[model samples]
Target chain A: MDQFIKINSLKKVFGEGEDEVHAFGPVDISIKSGEFVSVLGPSGCGKSTLMLMMAGLLEPTSGEIYFDDKSVSGPKNDIGIMFQDNTLVPWRTVEGNIKLQLELRNLDISKYKDKIFNILKSVKLEDFAKRYPSELSGGMQQRAAFCQAMIHEPNTILLDEPLGKLDAMTREKIRSDIQNLWMINKPTVIFVTHSIEEAVQLSSRVILISPRPGIVDREINIDLPYPRDLSVKRSNKFFEYVHEIQEVFHEYGVI
Target chain B: MASSKNKLSGFLKWIASGWMLILFFVLFFLFWEYSIPLFDVPRYILPAPTEIVQKGSADIDKLIYYTGVTGLETIIGYAIAIILGLGFGIAISFSSILRRTLYPFFVSIEMTPKIAFAPLFISWFGFGLLPKVIIVVLVCFFPIVLNAILAFNSLSNELTLFHRSTGANPLKTFFKIRLPAAMPQCFVGFKYAAINATVGATIAEFIGSDQGLGFYISIVTGNMRPDLAFAGIFFLTLLGLSLFGFVTLMEKILIPWHISMKRINK
Candidate 1:
């Protein structure tokens, strides 16, 4: 079986000896080809920095990341990274924006046009294919960003607080949509957010990372059934896990 | 039906706004008619509105001919400035190394006065349309380039990243994202370029050209026909204003999103 992604003893230090700041690492994590794992922790806990290292945007001070048996270095064609800020080029239309992945690889655009349209329509921005990013509302822009991420069909997607900018209602709508997109595509995904409830709701497994110079505090496999609803929050099992994780943070004075 | 009513009301409001401008003009003419005469001003020094109008209409055919010649030069010069300035600006902005090396050079050149260079342009380009167009291009280039850079450089980085992550090719990104993003600023550049370029053309014409309002003024002024000189000067101002208005129209059409002109018209 393809071990979709593996992180081994990763470490990242920002400065020299005494002034050194350690951002998430000297830890190991792994995900199977189709697993959805969410890393949850308090702010300053280094979950996002860890994701950045894994996504190839930031280099690790030491350690290795393997994608489908291949050692990862910098950005790879098989991976896609999304963040709170959607960097849409100002000059292109919605369709042009989505096809950027294919364009970057110098791939045939004709083949991807229909798929891009489908994604745009699904996001309710089919009518906006010709509109610039500046013309969009924040929610619409984020939806378009999501469409762009999905356009290339990358096997691994790393999201860094993508839904953090939206209002609660829009956030919930997009959150479910992202989870659905992951399930349908079965992309090995690493969703990094500081929200424990969000991690519980979205992840197949929740991994809590400790504060800067981060180490894995705990990893728990969620046994909840599929198409899970927020109503599941009322369940004793859900509260137990949330409380168990909360206690871990409480011990660290991070809750 | 409801929209039609709204439009009608809008038109009425527009007509009402016209009154204030009309009042200003009326007051200005009255001052021209009475104030100078009351102060016993000399005709060579200050002509009344009626006298200027009489001078303008005295040789209607000559004024019309001269207006056409100068108008043609101004329009041509202005067009050249807009097209060439925009091209040069975009080219420089596209290359970071070029921008870094040439930007300071262009700024220094922009600050150097073209009026002092008039005799040199006359000697170099001769008494023809070339010198005038060159002057216009020089006058217009700086603003368009500055505004283009400001517009192009100021795009939201987050939006740019979104496009890259999606894999948009550089050319597509420039057209879809960069160009539209720079539009409003481009219009601002155009407005300044259009007006200043007209003045440049007139000055260049005054220094050496055989035909144009500036040439006519040079001859008319020496002849002590102050009324005619004043009439020509007024028309020159009018021509510049017309060009400015045209650039403004283009701006409204190009970047309707700009705040300045949004409430005015379609």
Candidate 2:
């Protein structure tokens, strides 16, 4: 796979003059297609900001992002994004919410009916397709959100802590579910999270961002085998990868 | 078979939930019936419920006619307000120019007592259907518009981001995501406007109209027939409740997925 996304010297400054706050940085990173890259950082470290800019939802104060050699000026339909909040349209059912992406992309909804079911089934939400977001548990709602993000089958997926709101058990469950879904499609995913274990477990490469005015602190390649489940999580190899990232945060006084 | 049984149980539970309120009203009415005579309260001052019911039944045709007139005015004015309020609200949400110019103007109009305009409307439009409808419009329009503005503006930041990421056009976003997301709050406006609709029509009638429950109440009260006046008031209450009920029904139909409605269903 070729270089799918490139962020060069990107910086974001909020407000102006006297009140200016340097939110993110002159950070540089390149993600190849089909690579699961996690942007690990502490709170207020602009990980979410970085993801937003990459998705072309937020314009950086300076620098540019290239997607497949094309300069990203505005929001691109070729990439899927999920935020911490499930953001499911409460009025729509789980299936209807996923269908919404297809509807927005002007794709024929009838064609993706099978895909919708399959995605829902992968997230264990097959029975919940007809249920409203409010009726679902917090984890279930996030799973539905995951389905929505995957429905378009975009080449790139930007996930900004999509499982941030779920409890420990549910987050672990959904995390694996997300991996399973991502494996099936093999979309290049930029997963932004504060968790060292999460970053190490899910991504092929982990990009650690430091505190405010965030810059790439370290890039650790996780050469772990496929299906980084409980066994992989318990392995000495995974612990070593997690400890390495933790040491970076430790240096930043984040932990 | 289990589903049918569940349905039966659900029906029974619904009835059980409602009966206590009905029973309270029944008891209260009984107490009022006996206490009025015990207190030696003059019939003209406050007619007993029984007397009001008797007088109301006897004058049912006239009462129904006036009720219909007021109901018509309320419905028309309320419907027009719904369309105009929602239109302006959506427009204001889309355009900063409209928000700056029209929004403050609407706020100022809303701040002033709408009932005060009843006499002015009657003088301008005369003692006819027009004046009453105008008053109803003034009363109902502001709440709907205000709530609508709040509703449309209340789309969550995450949802807005999701919408942007999809590259959904403004028109599609408004209909598919923004509109549906704004609905629960919009229903808040709708229900409030429904409550105000009757008040607007009745107050306008009080100032000028020759027809309607409001006019009937004024005339009967002046003629020292409190029973008949109360009967007119009784019809007005029914009209207000039914109008409110209609909006609530729409809310249930449109947003059954809403948390408020979900709690009710549970």
Candidate 3:
């Protein structure tokens, strides 16, 4: 597997001198091309900080990140990010929000209209193309946000607990939708989440980070087959994987 | 049939919500009309509402002309303030140095009695429409600039990061993300500015101008025609309401996606 993203001992510290706070790192991570990796940890563990550094949204206090052999300096066009909150501009309609990806890239909207419409249709938001974020349900908004992030068809996608605030049913549905999307697109994804089950379900590998000044404590391979559904979650195999990840947390005394 | 019944119910609901306000105004005005005579109050002290209405109707054309002048001053001043406010706001937001240098200056100006500037404006511009417009701009400019600063700074880190990650240039990010996200707050500033614009114009006219409702009121009151002064006041109220309503209507049209606007639309 080609290393699409390589993080070399990245560290982030806030403030200076006496007031300094260690955010995360001296952490190293490498993600393969077309791989889905989840960073799971306890709250305030700087999992999100790690993800941000990977996305080039946050500057590492010290260290380097490489994307496809090129050092990541700043936000790259080929990277997509979705935050925990669906940060859809409130004033834009569903279609408009999706179109923002194309607009930002200065891509021809007329050429991509069909592509956008198709994405909306696939997400079951075709009827809500004209509706605003405020008019949509939490799940629908998250779906719209997912569409927004994926619209430009970035090679690498970084998600910061995108489904953390959603209800269980909605979360499961979006998680599955994400899986189906990943299966189709095969983009390298670095998803940050606190949910062990979510990490187990979605990622090809799970990177567990220890609480605060977070370090990559463990990496667990899901070894699950593709096209996973709710039934797989019920199976003993899924529980075993979940249990295995939970035990890593138990070792850290985090759970 | 169902549609018509729904319309009827909607109308009934509207009336139900508004009846108290209507009743309060009516009873209050009736008391004013009767109490003036009962208490033997002179006309110049407190004219009856009927007397004021009669005086207003008699001078309707003159009143309308003054109303138009004041309205124009308010609208034009507000428009200028909107442009300048947004410009200054963006400038301040774009650079921390400028924000630090200019924020206190703006705060001091805002804190200073706006009326204190009235005489200086009249002296510089000489009691013309220009002075009144300047006053309106001065009065209305602060809220817009302040609110715009608030709006621009209020851009969420996630949204900015999303924009940046998509390769949006700073200019594109500002226009597409910052401006749109800040619109609801911008409208709030606009609403306050609109109302203040009217007050600004009227205050300028009260100090110096001779061709607005403010001037007309001064003249009528000096002439001991309290009824006509009351009529001028009535027109002023209308001007305030009209400007406020116009801004609110624009808000609805522009930011129907805003939660408050969305709820209203629903």
Among these predictions, the greatest DockQ belongs to 2
| Model 1, residue A168: C-alpha shift (Å) | 2.5
Identify the runs in model 3 with alpha carbons over 4 angstroms from their true place: B1-13
What DockQ results do all the predictions give, each relative to the true complex? 0.27, 0.83, 0.76
User: What lDDT does the true structure give each of the candidates?
Assistant: 0.79, 0.90, 0.88
Top-TM-score candidate index? 2
lDDT of 1 by residue, B1-266 (tens): 99999999998988798889989999988988999879999988778889989987986677778777778877887787678767877877888886988777887887888667878878998998777777777777788887877778777755554454445567877866678778888888888887786688778878887877888888888887778888888878888889898888787667665555646653
Q: To one decimal, what is the Cα RMSD in angstroms of model 1 from the true structure? A: 4.3
Deviation in Å, model 1, residue B42 alpha carbon: 4.4
Quote the positional error of residue B162 for candidate 1 in Å. 4.0
Estimated TM-score for each candidate:
0.80, 0.96, 0.94
Best by lDDT: 2
How far in Å is the alpha carbon of A216 misplaced in model 1? 4.7
Q: Give TM-scores of chain A for all candidates.
A: 0.92, 0.98, 0.97
Model 2 lDDT per residue over A97-192, tens place: 999889988999999989999889998899999898888899999989988988888888989998887799988888899889888979999999
Instruction: TM-score for candidate 1, please give it.
Output: 0.80
What's model 3's overall lDDT? 0.88
How well does model 1 score by local distance difference test? Answer: 0.79
Worst 10 residues of 2 chain A by lDDT: A245-254
Candidate 2 CAPRI-style tier:
high
Share of true Cα-Cα contacts across chains kept by each model: 0.26, 0.91, 0.88
Per-residue lDDT for B178-221 in model 3, tens only? 88888988888898888788788888888998799999998888
